[model samples]
Target: MNNLFLRNQLCVPVKGYNRAIIYDILRKDYFLIPKEHCAILDTNDFIQFDKIEDVEEREELIDFLVNEEIIFQLSTSEQKKHFKSLNRNFENPNPLTNVIIHSNIDFRFLDLIKDQYLLNLSIISQEIDDNLLAILQKVSELEIDSIYLYIENSNIEKLDEYKKLFANYSLIFSVNFFNSKKIIDKTQLSQNIYYNFFEEEFSTYKRTLSIDKLAINAEHFLEAYNFHSYYFAKVYIDENGNIKNGLNNLENFGCIKSLTSSQFKEIISSSNFKELGTIKKKETLVCCDCEYRYMCVDSRVPSKGKKHWFHQFECVYNPYLSKWSNEEGYLNLEESGVYISASGCTIDQEKLSENFDKIWNT
Candidate 1:
C-alpha cells in the first residue's frame, strides 16, 4: 500500500497544446494534465513513491492518478478489479457499432434496421415524412434497440408529431439549432428529442464530449472502438445506395440494396475494412498526443496530408507550441509580421477603412 506503480500508460506531449496527455491504453482512459496541478511526477520514469516530494499538492495529484487507474498504488485492490473488467471488454469486443447513414432516399433506412443496432438517420431534409412512421414500422417488423433522427431547424414544426409517434421505444431526435432562436422549449421537447448544437458556427472555444462521463452514463463508451470516426467499424449507406465503410469514403463494400448477410460478412472480413477501422488517434500525427483524441469524433479521411490527421483549419490550438492560434485567416506575429484588418482578415487597411466607411454611411 505504501508503493505506487505506474500502469502501462503512455504520457505523450501534445503537438498543439504542449501539455502532456496521458493514454491508459489498456483501460482506454485519457486525461489532460490538470491546470491547477503544479507537477506530473515524471511518469515516463516509473514513479517511486518514496522519492516524490510528498507535499499536499503532489499527494493530491498522486491520489487522483491512482484513482484514475493511469497509475495505481501497488497494494490497491480496486485497480486490479477495474483492469479485469476493462480487459474482458477489450478481449470480447462488441462487433456491433452504430451506423450514421445520411440519405435523401427515405426507404433505404429500412434495409439497415434488420439488426438490433443503433441507427442514426441523418435525414438531409427537415420537411420529410415523419421519422416516427419509419421508427414505428421498424419497431413492428424488426428488432432494433435504438433509433435516432438528425434534423434541421426547419423540422421544429414536426416535433409534436414525433413525440406521439416515438413514445414507445425512446426514439430520439437530435438537431442543430441555437438556444436564442427558441424554436421549442427544451423542457418539453426533451421527451423525444436531443439537441446537439456542437456544429453551430457559434464560439471561440469549442467543447468535446467527455469519454469517462460517456462511459458512466452510457454504461460503455459507444466510441471506445471507433477509430477513423468516419464509418470505420460501422457502415455508411450513401445517397446512391452504395455501401461504404464511411461517408465520402470511396472504398465501397458494395451496394446496400443487394447486400446479403453472407456478402456483408465477406465485405467486412477483408483486410482493407479492418485496417481502416483500427486507425486510432495514437497512430495519427498531432492527434496521437492530443488529450481529446479518444473523446473526439474526428473524420480522419479529411486530414490525410494536412498538418493534423483530423482537421487542420478547424483546429485553433498548436499542442507543440502550446499557444491557441488566432482566427483562421489572420496571420499571427510568428507567421507574418504584417498587421491584419479589424475584421480578422489578412487584408490591407485601405479596404478595411472602406468597409468601415460603407457601414457608417449606411
Candidate 2:
C-alpha cells in the first residue's frame, strides 16, 4: 500500500528496538527492516491532503519527508510508470519497506504499490467480510509476501478457517492468547507447546526448576534431540537462578530431568571420548545467569538493567513491575496469574562468565 494508507493502519504504538531485539534472539534471525529504519509519526506530523487547498502546500510535506530520509517520494508521472513496470516481474522481492494501513475502507491506493512494497493490511477481526476478502485477493494477485491476520477471541473460529484457506501463503497470525484459553488449547500441537509458569498459582512450579535445574534440563534436551527449529514464547528469569515460564515449565520436571540425565549418562559412558582444544580466557567477561541460561542456544545481555551482564530479556509481554515488585516474588500467583522472580537479582558479569566456563567443561 501507499504510505498514507499504511500510516493510518497502526493500532498501537510500535514497540521498536525492544521488540526487534527479543525476536531476533528467539528466532535466531535478523530483522529484514532494521530497527534504525523505524519511526513513529505523530498525527501532527502527518501531511493532510484535505487541509492543503494549494497543490504546492501538499507537495511541500512530501518533499520534507523525502529530504529527511523518512520516506521516498516519486513524481506522479514516475509512480505511474513504475506501477506499469511492476507487473513485468512478480518473483522479485520488493525492496520497499512495509507500510501498515489502518483503515477498514477499500484502499484502492494499495493496489498501485502492492507489487512495489510490503503492504500490511490491518482490519478489525470482527468486521472482516466479503469486502475484506476482495482486498486480500487483490494483494494475493500481486504475489506479496502475505497478509498478516489480526484476530481476537470472538473471531478465532473465523481465523481458523482463514488459516486453512490461505494455508499455501506465508501468513503470520497475531493474537493475544492471554484471554483466549479455548483458542490457545485448540492450537496446541506436538511441536508447539505452551506453559504458564509466570502465573502466581505456579509459584511452586517455579521453585522446583531453579536456574540450575533449568540449565540441566536444557542441556539434556539438546543432547538428546535432533530437531530443526525450536520456538519459545513469553519466557523470563530472575535472581537466585529461579526459572519462570516457557516449555521447560511443563509438568513433571523431576521425571523429565531424571530421564534426561540417565540418557545423557548412558551416551557419554558408552562413548570413547577425546578432549577438544581449549581457548584462553579473557580478563573481562559478560554472562547470563537466567534459569534457562544453559539451555538457551541463543542468548545475549540487555544493554540496560542491573542484570545487564548475565540476563537477557526473553519475554514478549511487557514486564509488569507491580507484580514483579511484590514481596511474594511470584507472578500470577494470586489474582493476576503472572510470574515474578523472587530474588530480583541483577546480572553479575563475572559470575555468569565463570558459570559458563564450568558448564562447558562439565
TM-score of 1: 0.59
CA deviation > 4 Å runs, candidate 2: 1-95, 119-124, 153-163, 168-179, 184-362
The TM-score that candidate 2 achieves is 0.28
Candidate 1 lDDT score relative to the true structure: 0.47
Tell me each candidate's TM-score: 0.59, 0.28
User: Quick one: best TM-score, which candidate?
Assistant: 1
lDDT of 1 by residue, 1-362 (tens): 45546554333222222355554444555566743231344444446545445577567767777777666555663454443222212332534455655435446446545553444434332433555345445544644444555443345556556556446545445443332254434334456555443223222111222231222111222343335544455766666777676544677768767766656656766776666666666656555535455445544353443333343243343333333354233323224322222223233446544533443356
The Cα error of candidate 2 at residue 292, in Å, is 14
Cα lDDT tens digits, model 2, 128-247, are 466545555656665444454433223445555644544444433332222344443434322122211122222232223222222223222332122101111112212222222222
Point to the candidate with the largest lDDT.
Answer: 1
Specify the poorest-scoring 10-residue window by lDDT in model 2.
Answer: 274-283
RMSD of 2: 25.4
